[model samples]
Target: MYKAHFGLREQPFGITPDTSFFFACPSYQEALNTLLIAVRNGEGFIKITGEVGVGKTLLCRKFMTTLGDEFVTAYIPNPFLEPRALMFALADELEVSLEKDVDQHQLLKSINHRLLVLARAGKRVVLCLDEAQAMPLDTLEALRLLTNLETEKRKLLQIVMFGQPELNHKLQQEAIRQLNQRITFHYHLGPLNKDDMEFYVSHRLSIAGYTGGRLFGSSAIQAMYASSGGVPRLVNILSHKALMLAYGEGKHEITARHVRAAARDTGAARNKIWFLGWLAAAALITVGTSIGWAYFK
Candidate 1:
């Protein structure tokens, strides 16, 4: 809604995991670099963990998109499947046709054959799983079996798991320790710092076609850093609502007041959580009344 007033080409703060809007702050760059290195070395399994809204999904998409021609990537956005379902998902991703009555043993054999064919063609296959913390315990064990398909020198499949902090606890279980031990590269994707948060906002605005200088005031940036604690997704949520407040006021720049009002209306800062969900009903009413009064007056 504020794009026209701000001369932006699109919404700068959408929550979708769009790789095109990726802002390579230090943590994101480091995580991406680590994943790339791990894949290149043919690591059997790699893990990237972060708190919610820290941009793991976006990083995963960007990593897959940027892979070189020698790589073939399969993305599994959902990880709550059973071991059999997991195998079927992989087989589907690899374009391995399956008969209606094919059992688990036959299915796995089909997948192994596909991996070998791709390896012979000089292409490395990488499987990426998002929300891996929810994967069934048995299914995780199944993944270790899949990784065992290898040539003499390297693994046939490289796996990368993107999950929240709970994935670490899940990996610690006795049944899954083998899979955990196979993780040769691991990185914790943390939130942004103040400087990176500010830079992130500017970078996204510029990408959205905003040529207007300094759309967010220094005080506004300070408020955002405090309210969002340098999380990219929270920053986007707050900045977006604050911009709407400013737009309603016919103002061109954001201020601390706008940030506070936006925080009160957002479930993120209001509930002491990171960016998530919509504002509570009462908070919504209050902010709506306040914004209406200010705008109309």
Candidate 2:
């Protein structure tokens, strides 16, 4: 809504995992590089773990987008399925034809055939599973089995799992130890640090065609860092709200007050001191007024 007012072609703080708006902060860059290097090395299973709203999905989308033509990429955004259903999802992504009511064995055979064909054609097939912690145990084991289909040199189907930190706990399960062991390159994506957050917000704004002075002031940036804990998604949310409030109030610059108000409205930052101080001062003012009235009477 404020895009025109902000002089931008699009909303800068959108929550969508748009690869175009991706900010290459240090941690995310490292994670992407780690995935690229590991996959190039024919690593059977590469895993990225991060907390919710830490931009794992965004990083995954960017990686797949930039992965280029040498690889055939299949993305499974939601992996909460039975072994048979999981196979169907992968098949659908790979464009492997499936007849109606095909049994599990037949489906697996078709997938294996497709993987082999891609391998022969000098194409690397990568299966990227997002939200992988929700994947069924049997399905994860099935994925491990798929990795077994390999030439003498490298594995046929490379797997990259992007998931919440729960995925690590899932990996620790004894049942999926083989899959866990196969994860040679692992990157845990954490929130951006304070300095990174400053750049991240500005970088996103610049990408969205923001031209002019810095929209977010330094104190406002500090408040953003404090409130968002440097999480990109949270920063986007808080910053977007602050922008709307600023625009509504006829302000061009985003101040710390604007950020705090946004935080209060958003149930983020949760600065009890602000509220508590307001309450305490109100109590004192009320008492003083009452005493003055009594003396006047």
TM-scores for all candidates? 0.91, 0.89
lDDT of 2 by residue, 229-270 (tens): 988899999999999999998888999999988888875455
After superposition, the stretches of candidate 1 with alpha carbons farther than 4 Å from their true spots are 273-297
Clashing residue pairs found in predicted model 1: none
Error of 1 at 18 (Å): 1.3
Which segments of candidate 2 are over 4 A away from where they belong?
A: 268-297
Residue 44 shift from truth in candidate 1, angstroms: 0.7
Best by TM-score: 1
Q: What is the Cα-based lDDT of residue 16 in candidate 1? A: 89
Top candidate, metric lDDT: 1
In the order shown, the candidates' Cα RMSDs to the true structure are 9.0, 7.3
Residue 223 lDDT (model 1): 94
Candidate 1, 191-226: lDDT as tens digits:
999999999999999888999889999999999999
Query: Each model's C-alpha lDDT?
Result: 0.92, 0.90
Clashing pairs in 2: none
